[model samples]
Target: MRAINAIRMGGVDVLPLVEGGKGVSISNGLSAGNWALAGGVGTFSAVNADSFDVNGRAIPQVYHGRTRRERHEELVSYAIQGALTQARRAWEVTGGKGRIHANILWEMGAAERIITEVLEQAKGLIHGITCGAGMPYRLSDIAARFNVYYYPIISSARAFNALWKRAYSKTAELLGGVVYEDPWLAGGHNGLSNGEDPLRPEDPLPRVMALRKVMRDFGLHETPIIMAGGVWCLEEWESWIDNPDLGPVAFQFGTRPLLTQESPIGNAWKQRLLTLKEGDVFLNRFSPTGFYSSAVSNGFLAELRERSERQVAFTTETIGEHVAEYGVGPRKRIVYLTYADRERALAWERQGFTDALRTPDSTLIFVTPEKAREILEDQTACMGCLSSCRFSNWAQHEPDYTNGKKADPRSFCIQKTLQDIAHESDEPAAVERNLMFSGHNAYRFGKDPFYSSGFIPTVKQLMERLLTGR
Candidate 1:
């Protein structure tokens, strides 16, 4: 393997391997700091990261607000403080050595506010900002205001072109890098556009070359393109390095870092990664943010799949082939379904899915009475985590503060599940019941000899391993 060399990113020379940021305290200061200490870019997630008390113990994010709006405000406050705390920790670990970037989701509730406050408070501690999950046109402006670099995470060349033409061109100097996150294989929320098919995985080389071409068109030839998603080892990506067509490129490891010693995920969650198979990580489109996401095919996902499977389309007015009347909810509101669908619904009800819940897509999904109650409770308890949520129909801004759509039963509250999975004690049951995000290459953990006997490497050790191309 060719020797790994330091590359310039965020106006600093460092190893091209960047630590990908995970959310809900999974990628905390320890992991980010250690990665930075290893002479690589360290990114701590600002998406609802945890803040600690005086003794450094994590304070539980228990919401006492009476209204969803009030809870949302509290959440934003928590997010800002948490980001600051993590930034400080990362800076401390780095000792003014490596680059530190804060990662945020553009669609997250009060995203602009959180990032603005974090940059204002963090100052020189954070060197860059990496954002994705939406077209964050305003990201460059915020980063420029703070005198930090901005890395916009995108899956296609068109996304970068749109960003460059709109807001990024103005702050071209501080445009640190562009993160090319593979939509079909990347973990967590994906940027899969309507034109793309999730079932068909495309080669990263062609797409990245296209992105490089677009970047060059905007006079961004020198800016590094951070390759993220499905990146396990440097050996497989040897050809990508020093490839003139792609220009300066860096590798971002999202899933591999989860098994590291400093990763903040619970032990049960870490252990589960070692036993995964090729098809265990599923690219699903069930996010409340209305974006495609990749997660483990665990019990939580299985339940969602089952609920969606029990769904039947309905119409208010009877049309051809949709003439069967069905009563939904306690009020017995009438909706028309097909004869075959009615029979399917009856069969599901007989199988203990007695309650029928209406979705935003003019569909009714059958679920257990207990599950129906749980879904309502989760929706009622929504604190507007996302800018707009399909599960609870909660929108952060404007007149009514609602998306003006019926709550979809097929999706669940992401904030609640992430916090649950991240903070829960080392218990397999709790870990399995919540969302577990992973890249498609997570199966490599079991197959790789480096992870034999479930040996979790430190960030420095992993860097050493990557350097040897093992």
Candidate 2:
């Protein structure tokens, strides 16, 4: 195995290993700080991070606002305070050892405002900002304003080129690095574009090389390209090390860190990771952000798959093969469906999935009455977590504050599920019911002999093991 060497990143020399930030308190201060203390870059998730009370107890984020707009304001306030708290905690643990970066989603609600507030309050503690889930063209500007390095996460060379040409070129000196997250392999929200197929996984070498070419064209030869997703053993990536084609490279691990002792996830979640098979992790486009994400194919995901599978197209006026008439909702609004589809829909309705919810694509999905009520309640209680949500039809814009479409029932509230999963006690039931974001390589925990006895390593131990290319 090639010896791991320190590299200059974020204006400092450190090991080119980064702990990828997971949101909703999955990767907290302790985990990230410990990684930084191990002489590597640590990224704490700033997206709805947790805050503590005076007694050092976790403060529950219970919303009391009646309107979605008011709740969104409350959420933003909580997020800023939480980010500051996490940043302070991480800084205290780091002891000024290595670089500390704050991670945020570009498509998150009030992303710019939340990031600005966090940076303002926790100025010196955070050395860099890493953003993903969208084309964060304004990230460079934000980092420049705060005088910190910026890393924009992209999946393709085209995305990086677009950001560079539009805004990144102006803040060239502050360009710390470019994170090329593998869309098909990464956890959480993926950056897979419309042109890309999720079923087909591409080799990262060619993609990273293309990204390096783009960076070199922009006079950023020295800047490192942080490779994220599908990265497990460094021994396998020995060829990538010191390769001139992809200069100054780093690896970001998101799933591997979740098994560490400092990981904020519950014990049940940790145990679940050790038992997963290769095909357990699934990549799907069920996210409210309208982006592809990878997660465990648990009962939660299976339910969504079933709901989508039971869907059929409908039209207001009969046309072509849409000859059968069907009624939807309490109003019994007439819609046309095919004779075969009508029979299928009737079968589903008889099976207690009587409520047919219309989707944005002119399709009706059947759900149980109880599930329908829960979906409505969740939508009603939306605090606008995302910039725009397909499930709740909530947009951050002020005038309308709506996506101008019916709330799709196929998707659920991400903020609600993440908060529940993160804060829930060490219970398998709770963990299995929510979205469990994980990288495709997560199944390796079961196959790896190191964790055969269900042994969970601390952040330091994990870093040491990774450094040895084990």
Candidate 3:
């Protein structure tokens, strides 16, 4: 195999490798800093990252606000402080070597404010900004204001073209790269559009080529296209390296780094990765952001599946074949359901799923009394983490501050579950009970010989191994 060479990215020559950012402090200063230390671009997630106190201990992000809007303010403040700290740490670790990029979900609450504040406070520390999870049209403007490069993560060439023509064209100089995150292979909040079939994943090579062509049409020929998701080894992607048709290219690893020593995930999460089989990672639409995500097929996902399965359409007034009267909630509000559906609901009730919660689509999902209470409590404690959440119906707009829809019980509170999974300890079931986002190729962890006997590598060691085309 040919030796891997450094590529110019964000105005710096670093190995054509990037650590895909994980949120809720999953990818933090320590991990991203070490990744930069290894001569690769390190991307630390600014989405509610953890801030440390003077004693070097993480400060718990507790909300003391009375309303969701108030708590949203607190969340934004916390995120800015955390992002600044992570940027500083990553810059320090580079030692005048690689580059550090801050990643943020555009759908995150007050994303523009948080990124602007972090960049204003930590100027010269962060070299670039990587943003996705939404259109993120304002990202280039923000990066240009800060004199930093911006990388927009998109799954399709058409999406990139739309962004380039609309907003990115203005700040074309600051556009560092375009990240092509495969919707099917990537973990956590996939970009699968309405036209694409989730079950039928298309080849990433063709998709990336199409993206490169669009970039070329926009006169962005040299901008590297970062191929993210399902990129485990460099050997498998040798054809993508130095390919003339694709132009400058880089590989992003979202799952392989979870077992590294610098990774912040718990030991149980790492152990679970090693035991996963080929089909263990499941792709489902359970996120409050209304985006499809990939996660481990654990107890948490199973419960969500069961909840959606026990659903039935209903109406308050009589309609065709909807004459079966059913009472829901403590008030016993009567709704009409189909006779066959009523029997199914009754059967679910016999199995202890007696609480029927209404969804935004006029459907009711049955759950146990305890489960219903927990769900309500979780919704009540909403901090407005996302700009628009289906679970809590929390929208970050003026006046009503709601999504103008009924709070859907089918989707769980993402803020609560993500925070719990990222930092939870001592609880034995936390790993299996919270969302464990992983790429479709996460099962390779069990088969990879380099990780035999559970030998986790440091970020530097992982970089070295990757450079060897393994």
Candidate 4:
């Protein structure tokens, strides 16, 4: 396979390939740098990125403070430092060929602040920024200040158009491209909206064309649409190449990139990825962030599925206002429920549904005590760096979402577990406790002769295989 020519992305000639940013430690500076070195775009995840250490040893960042605002500030500061560190590391690894991009979630309370500080601190090292998980109307403006290109990951043309109409218009000049991340197949948080039914998956071609039409409508015909999620070997997607229906197209790889040698993920996680089988990927709303995500149906995810199955909607007000004793306390006793729900819950418990427990915020329900205990221990063993977690409500500093409330138990403390997994910590004892994001096609590795060791390839090798179709 001949090497593909570089495409213009945010004013830089970059390989069409993009390293989709994975949070925690999935796609950090090392991985992104390698991607850029390979002549592709690398997106370093700045969300909960590690900032510093006490004596050159990495420090755990937990918001032990008293208020939400205080906790948010600490998180913002740490992210800023983390972003800078990752950028410099990437620059060193890439030797300056690849453009380093930062990926951030849009809904962070201090998103704008963190981004500003990151770009300011990273300076020229960071060349572009990619944001998703929510409509990032302000992304263009944020990227503009640094003269960096901006890419907004979206699932549909309608969502893109809405952003353009409401806020992105002003930053259109600096808009590098749009990332059409396939909601159903991509790892991490999906962009699926309430109006969109999960069961009804729309065809990608039509949606791509619609996006192209929107670009044309906005006079952005020259802008490329970076197709993400479910993209494997080009052989599987040759029909879309140079096809007018999906104009100015480029493909982005999320899960596929993890197999690369240069990928920043831990070796164990990578090995786990190689063994996945078809139909093993699942999409569910297990993230405390309140977003639906796609991941492997491993022990962790299976438990969540089981817990959901046991769920029977219960109301606070009984038939008219009936109070029920759901837990052992007054607070638990105050819960209202219908007879049917009570019967169903009791039945589920009798049938072994005793694993259910409240989320950290107490607003949602999760698996029973066994798993909840596992998750809590996982939380307490904090490597510490999520902005606001539901599991432990552990912030980086004090005054955390302290609203005088404990972190919701419904939401797992992402910082604690992800850091542990990334660092290969043995404290958790169970890899299945954390969510593992992967694509639906992650099973391809098992059949590939090149991956016999379960030895994951470096980013360079992975990119070569992708570009060469071998």
Task: List the lowest-lDDT window of 10 residues for candidate 3.
Answer: 419-428
lDDT per residue as tens, model 1, 240-350: 999899899999999999998888888999889999999999989899999999999999999999999999999998999999999998998999999999999999989
Candidate 1, superposed: residue stretches over 4 Å from native: none
lDDT of each: 0.92, 0.93, 0.91, 0.73
lDDT by residue (3-40, candidate 3, tens digit) is 78988888889889999999988888788889988888
Model 3, residue 254: what's the lDDT? 82
- Residues 329-414, candidate 4: write the lDDT tens digits: 22454555556666766776686545445433323343556666776665555333344444455544454433234645445656
Range of the 10 consecutive residues with the lowest summed lDDT in candidate 4: 357-366
Instruction: Give lDDT tens digits, candidate 2, residues 1-470.
Output: 89999999988899999999999888888888999999899999999999999999889988999999999999999899999988998989988665799999999999999999899988799999999988899998899999999999999999999999999999999999999999999999998989988898999899999999989998999999999999998998888888988899999999999998899888889999999999999999999999999999998899999999999999999899998999998999999999999999999989999999999899999999998899999999999999999999999997999998889899999999999889883899987799999999999999998787999999999999999997
Pairs clashing within candidate 3: none
* Window of ten residues with lowest summed lDDT in model 1: 423-432
- Between candidates 3 and 4, the one scoring higher on TM-score is 3
| Ten residues in sequence with the least summed lDDT for candidate 2 | 423-432
Taking all chains together, each candidate's TM-score versus the true structure is 0.98, 0.99, 0.98, 0.86
Model 1, residue 455: C-alpha shift (Å)? 0.9
Which portions of model 3 show Cα errors greater than 4 Å?
A: 425-427
Name the better of 3 and 4 by lDDT: 3
**Residue 231 of model 3, lDDT score:** 93
